[model samples]
Target: MGSITVSGVGKAYKFYSSRWARLAEWLSPFHKRRHTLKWVLQDINVSIGQGESVGVLGVNGAGKSTLLKMITGTTQPTTGSISINGRMAALLELGMGFHPDFTGRQNVFMAGQLLGYQAGEIAELMPEIEAFAEIGDYIDQPVRVYSSGMQVRLAFSVATMKKPDILIVDEALSVGDAYFQAKCFQRINNFRQNGTTLLLVSHSPGDVVKHCDRAILLKGGRVAMDSSSREVTNRYLDELFGKPDEAPADAEASIPTDSAAAHGLSQHDDVFHSRPGYHPSEHRWGHGGASIIDFLVSTPDASYPSRIESNTQTEFYFTVRFDSDFDQVVPGFLLKTLEGIFLYGTNSYLSSRGTAHHSAQAGSVQTYRFSMPMALNEGHYLVSFGISSGDPRQDLVPLDRRYDSVLIHVGRDVQFWGIADLRATYQQLNA
Candidate 1:
């Protein structure tokens, strides 16, 4: 049975003010003078059956890492019980279990032994592990010399080579390259298909939605929501951005101004060259003061191109409607990778090109267009749009925000390193 059952699990630490205070507490068990008990996780209970994929979602300091540790047996819970059956393998932290003095190849055997494998078995699996890690000669080098990415590759390869009954991955893919991260997901998917219990922890909601069958949201050291991935994700967003409501006022009393034309943007800028019959698939939320009616992504020539060319300029036209008068309005967009890693973002408050502030009455519809060059590498990107008020750089409030509003595809097999195509220039100087 590869099932995991956690009952009334809680973790706490004795926090002391000074170094001597810890000594004093150690000297006398009943002293308890200065140290305070701090609970990182409280009353967490969950059950996972064999071959089930579950995701743990939470913000920083929400005790996600603490819960993972307790499940992995790295740390014991201060209160309650945990029962885990079958062989369990975990990638909790970068370079967590490996010794600094040992080589990557040696650490593979070490980790295998810790996982209840004989020397002969580990030896047989060494070649597979070495090939999967792809660290070549560095496999014989000390692990201390390996970069964080290399260490993650080795650890992930070793943990997954043997096919444990229970596999736990805790943000380990965040350190690897994009290609390697994709490979890790494929491996995890294979584990799910082959009947291995999977427990994944990530801050990315997209990751949870893509990989987990069920998801649990942790807030303030407690279970906030537990349901299907879609329900949990929606609830998580609600908790984050507050509940969305209807517009507060009518849209007819607002001033109509040509802001796009004011910025030298016109219908001629609609460059929808190759893209045909475009339809938007967007997820929206925000306060009810205003709404984003529609948006367009094209070139300066007014042609809607199917894919963006590298190192070329593209324009984004966002049409927003206001039901109530507002003193300030901010419109923006963000580009993120398919894996939900943010690549770039800009807003009216932060951009030098857009108008400073927009004052509007009820029933106002305005279109704001932004010009940005496509300096990104060849990949599929998602655009998140936002219409907000107040200081967007500081305490901003979203009037309307849409995630994945536009899906952008940049074609051509350009082997550019990193996310942005920096367009670096090189010149050789004689020595």
Candidate 2:
């Protein structure tokens, strides 16, 4: 029977012209209003049944945190009312109540008192809290010295020590490392399973859709949309990023095959290093007898686009010249994360075409192309090219290796995290 209710709720802050104006107003027998009210939240009405998971999503300055603070009793609403019908625990702004000069252990005791735990009860749970935080001896040091991640760890540990009937988590957890974020979400999932009402605040549409049953989107301190998480997040994405109306081509579109036709490059141009995504800081090393010259990267409609939308299949074309005769040569390309973690790579020798090696005498050139679906989440990534004479792992002689030579920006390919775009879907079942 526990739930949250927000009815015509609004919040505002006082703005005075000067300190003397405030003093004069306070000193006057008939005090006149000398301050103006700046409204941060307006006419927000929401009701949640027991155990419902709702997400509050907005860009910065949208009054999401202000509403949560009002419900949690940390701040008062300027108009209307907010009520909570459960034992509530919240992880608000990081280190909100922590004393900078106090050690983490002491702060934990103080925060625990605020949460209705007596000294003896906190002592009983101290081992569990310390085990969960895992901050080591820094737990004995002043809160001022803790990193943002460390502060989140302690705050979250204390708030979640004993799961209440309700839980409110803000974006403060986003500052933690990936491992801790995973741990926190796992705990939240377990709480949800046990019928705990949850409120998650985040900028990520993927997180909202995955963890929440419903979502409320705020814009300009007003409730913009309140609906299913998917619907609200879709609107939020368009609002936040202003995506184009025309979606990316689902299947590859027909594009000009020749570099001269597609990219306005000379057929014999040696401008591989001048392309749009070319990286000047690329690491280059190889034997000197071969060179990679003209290159082109094309989507279905554009040549060397600054950003690729969705998981579009794209092609890369490059021409290589042999200065000295070679017994055999192999051309290859690979994709990597911005931090240089390899994703997928393939060589001409490994293709199904059965054209493993090409023999070229001195003063000979050949064009090579590789096409792949950019199956990655939205982020910045790098592409590399190489030419070698042997196996990739052993006795390999790299003739021309351009490491991280091109930077590709993928836009809204997947509404999820991680490097790969694992197109996932959900369906409700009839029980």
lDDT of 1 by residue, 126-192 (tens): 8888888888999999999999999999999988987778999999889999889888888889888
Candidate 1: where is the Cα deviation over 4 Å? 29-33, 239-431
What alpha-carbon RMSD in Å does predicted model 2 have with respect to the real structure? 9.3
Q: What is the lDDT of residue 91 in candidate 1?
A: 95
lDDT of 1 at 318: 68
> Which residue pairs show collisions in model 2?
none
**Top model number, TM-score:** 2
User: Could you give candidate 2's per-residue lDDT for residues 1-431 as a string of tens digits?
Assistant: 55999999999998899989899889889999899999999999999888999999998899999999998998999999988898999998998899999999999999999999999999999999999898999999999999999999999999989978899999999899988988888888998899899999997666787789999999888999999997887667655543333433421234855433344443455667755567778888898677877666778866666566658888887777778887778888888997879899888877636556677677877777888778788667888888877554457688888888877766672256687877788999999
How many pairs collide in each candidate, listed in order?
Answer: 17, 0
Please provide the root mean square deviation of candidate 1 (C-alpha atoms, Å). 13.0
Please give the lDDT score at residue 293 for candidate 2.
73
